[model samples]
Target: MMNKTNKILIQWLSWPIHVRIALIVILLILFFGELISVIEPKEFPTAFDGIWWAIVTVSTVGFGDSTPKTHAGKLVGMVTILIGASFAASYFAILSAATFQKQQAYVDGEIPFKRKNHVVIIGWNEKAHEMIQSLRAVKPFKQIVLIDHSLKEAPLMENVHFIRGNPTNDFTLLKANVKEADAAIITADQHKNELDADMQSVLVLLALKGINPSLYCVIEILTEHQANNAKRAGADEIIKTYQLTSHFIMSSYLAKNGLSTIYSKLNPATGNSFQVLPVPENLVGKTFKEASIHLLDQESILLGIKREEEAKMNPPLSYEILAGDYLIVFSH
Candidate 1:
């Protein structure tokens, strides 16, 4: 049934200009024709007869079977024919103008700011694309907004929206509804120089924080030096792309075949990825060993505790779980 409706719609849309105009004219004629029929039912006996007379009068066909006898019926027929002729002539012109408006809407970009509890990602690059793809995997149910001036249209993704404008601009940011987003990821500009791009990201961070002071924002910087500045600018978390990998690579090179590959597999995008779970209220005071055993029993491996302001990896078995602590677990 849906396919048949779709086919009919497609056929109607694909009809030539003259055909569409004529169809609309016929519909308008029928409407006024029915109204006239109701106003003077005795003159035009049936509704179909009124419609037939209206069509013939409009088209100059002059079929004698249903001619109007009274002055009122003649007036109705004359007005219907005039309206039908004027509408048919102007119909195609209005259609082309509306088509142009729709095309321009695409070029200008559209962002539905009503979207709430979604992730806003600023900037587009290899890393940003990877982040979006990874987000689709890990956070499939969540909406993602892409803000960039370069993109002409939205990326072909089900849960993603594209806002074509500068990320730092308040108009663009507001269009993405950044203030209401669950979280935001600000990435550096690859098109510009390294330091300049980092500065732009810092400026954007300040703008976002200015709008919503409590918003959780994760920022990407080129160098380790900018991490502190980004934090000062109101970044909740900062990822130093170059510096982070160097330390891991050095550790792997210095030590024997160690945990680098394990870390590589820890991407949240994959099915078997590291996840953070809250300390259960019932087991808030449980020992690390007890928590580990409980989680292991549930087929998840307990890795460590992310306590307030600290990360305790492989804590002593007797270490008690704190109330505000987060359990880092690896799930398959």
Candidate 2:
């Protein structure tokens, strides 16, 4: 019996500190309540009354409705006040500390993400920041997880969960719950040179695909040559940053305000932006011109058709739409 009792006590002591403190607080109240009721039955008529008095006295909310008349009961009350108050204070203090520690861990990016189907963005840069902001503007409630090893703390943004670790590491990807994520974006590391950045991005893409082959990955490659490597690594879409930037710069040079015009059209706040949608069943077997006319009535402009892995912008008017093709449109 003694061994069993000792084992039980040891098991209870091994429990979490907050749980132990809470249990101790409740036991203190019950033990003192029963003792005072037995010592002064006239003052505390029942165990319930003694418990009510104990609660009131322990909380220091002394109501003069109940008082101990005998010296023994008064001494019990004093002991209750001393021991009960200490346990109560300790419980609250531990609770507050635990809350603060959890919050601090989150800010420090030490907490792992537990939610599923979130968009995970790898690397921290101006492009990543803008992408996050743009995503928030488009879908206010969408969950986003940002992974980067360079950051000391998570960025302050709504619906953005940050994981501080190398994107190439499987452990880091798991920390962001990448296996359950809907999609992932691998941004080229700005700190490295063009070739090195593209290599790093491809490595991260490979890691992501290794963990979740179904994860739709969009990777940015600084060099055009690395785009094929990114595609070979299971990237669904590869953004050639240098080529696009050069084209945009050239366009701006040839036509004043070209860059600003493009930015304005792409801005979510403008309510006129690009959207990729599955080809409607009705649109299948129709020509590009017919699809354009059909979409025009709905205030959307058909810009391109994404068939399988290729996106042909402004295809010939007589081009026929297929069943599995996706339509790229500029919507207002």
Candidate 3:
């Protein structure tokens, strides 16, 4: 008994086979007519007239205005017409299929973005949603594409495109437009074994980098050791999930009551209530007092300034803000 999947596969394969056959037949008849015409000059009135005679004969649209004189030429023209008719039929079928595919993709919302810049999120996990929310918060305008093995349901958010397949699969990534994506964030594949997560992440990063060397990628890892391995695997950033959660829990305990509120609010929840705004390099020479106007103008509070591998939270009002400072800002 043939499985349903096998039936569907056969149906899909048939279309491509038909198209290929049509292409081959079209080329064969076209070349055969050209060769026969070249060999029989006296039989054709002129080159253009001969080509016209060939087209009409091969197409089975004999108008009788131009006919092959020699018996051999007439016999060849008859055979060529059958071949050309088959070729024309095949060409029409292929053309119709190509048009149908475009229309179907549009109807199904599978159209590619014209801008060609997007962030691709590979694999699915609880953390994947969090990362998406974080990215949406930080970069609201950024285009995001999600790829997963089982996308049974549509994403909760609007404009987040989905391509259902294995992230490590080259075809899947290509469908997600990974080559043109500005960045790719790969979360740990929860359905697979933990040991395999790092390997899969490496494969995905290698695939993307192989396509576009400058493409940036961030991989989520379960351990610090895996983080190091991922970095070596060409990850621009390796987020250690365990360490981050540990820090959060510890900080939450220390804060306890209202202090915990500060920690919770400060942590990137959804793209909604909190965000970090990197201070512009142009403002680096000035102090907080100088750049405070811009922050105030934006109606966002500067929680602190992160500069040169250090964070000075609630820096003194007089603190000097240097270049490369990132402002931890909170928006109500």
Candidate 4:
């Protein structure tokens, strides 16, 4: 019998601290309730009445309807108050501390993301910040994860999880749950020179693809020479930042209202923007002219066709649209 009792005690000690504290409080209440009933049999007629008085006394909610009539019962009430109040205070204090610690860990970017199908953005910059804001505006509930090595605290944003670590590191990518992510955008690191930044972006792409070969990656390349390298490293789309900027600058210099027209058309907030859609079943096996006419009827203009990985702008009217082809249309 003694050995069985010792084994039970050891198991109880192994329980969580909060569970132990809770059990002790309950046992004290039951013990004092039974003691008070025996001491003042007339005052607490039923066992339930004794338990009620004990609860009221411990909580300091004395209703005065039930009270200890004898000196012994009053002494027992005092003991219940002291012990119960202490345990209650300890439980609440521990609960508050735990909640605060969890919040602190999240702000410090120490929490690992567990959700799937989120968009991962690598490197923090003005471009990334703008992209996040734009994505939030378009899809308010889209999940986004930001990975950066230099940040000391996560950015305060809804639906955005932050992982503070080197983007090129495999562990960091895993922490962001990149293996299950839908897509990733690797922005050029602003702190490095043009060539070095491109190289770093390519390295991050390689790490991301190594973990999830099916992950769609869009990377920004500053130098023209590194564009091919980024593509070879498993980047689905490459954004040539310098070349795009140069085209816009030259256009603005040549035309009086070049950017104004282009910006207005590109802005989705203006109720019209470019949209990539799958080729409709009816459009398959049809000529480009027929596809353009069909899109025109729907208040859209067919700009180009994306076949597999290659995109052709304004293909010849006789060009045939095949199944699995995507259409790039300017829609209203």
Candidate 4 residue-wise lDDT at 6? 98
Tens-digit lDDT track for model 2 on 1-332? 99999999899989999999998889989999889899999989899999998888888889979999989989999999999988898999999999999999998888999999899999999999998988898888889999998999889999999898899999999999988999999998989999999999999999999999999999999887898899888889888888888887888888876565666567775577889999999999999999999999999999999999799999999999999999999997
Error of 1 at 96 (Å): 5.6
lDDT score of model 3? 0.72
TM-score of candidate 2 against the unseen true structure: 0.92
The TM-score of candidate 1 is 0.72
lDDT of 4: 0.89
Decide which is better by lDDT, 2 or 4. Answer: 2
Task: Note the Cα lDDT for every prediction shown.
Answer: 0.82, 0.91, 0.72, 0.89
Candidate 2 residue 208 C-alpha distance from true site, Å: 1.5
Candidate 3 regions exceeding 4 Å error are 1-115, 130-143, 152-157, 193-195, 258-294, 309-319
Clashes of each: 0, 0, 3, 0
Alpha-carbon lDDT of model 2: 0.91
What are the models' TM-scores?
A: 0.72, 0.92, 0.55, 0.84
Worst 10-residue lDDT window for candidate 3 reads 263-272
Which 10-residue window in model 2 sums to the lowest lDDT? Answer: 257-266
Alpha-carbon RMSD to native, per candidate: 10.1, 2.1, 10.8, 3.3
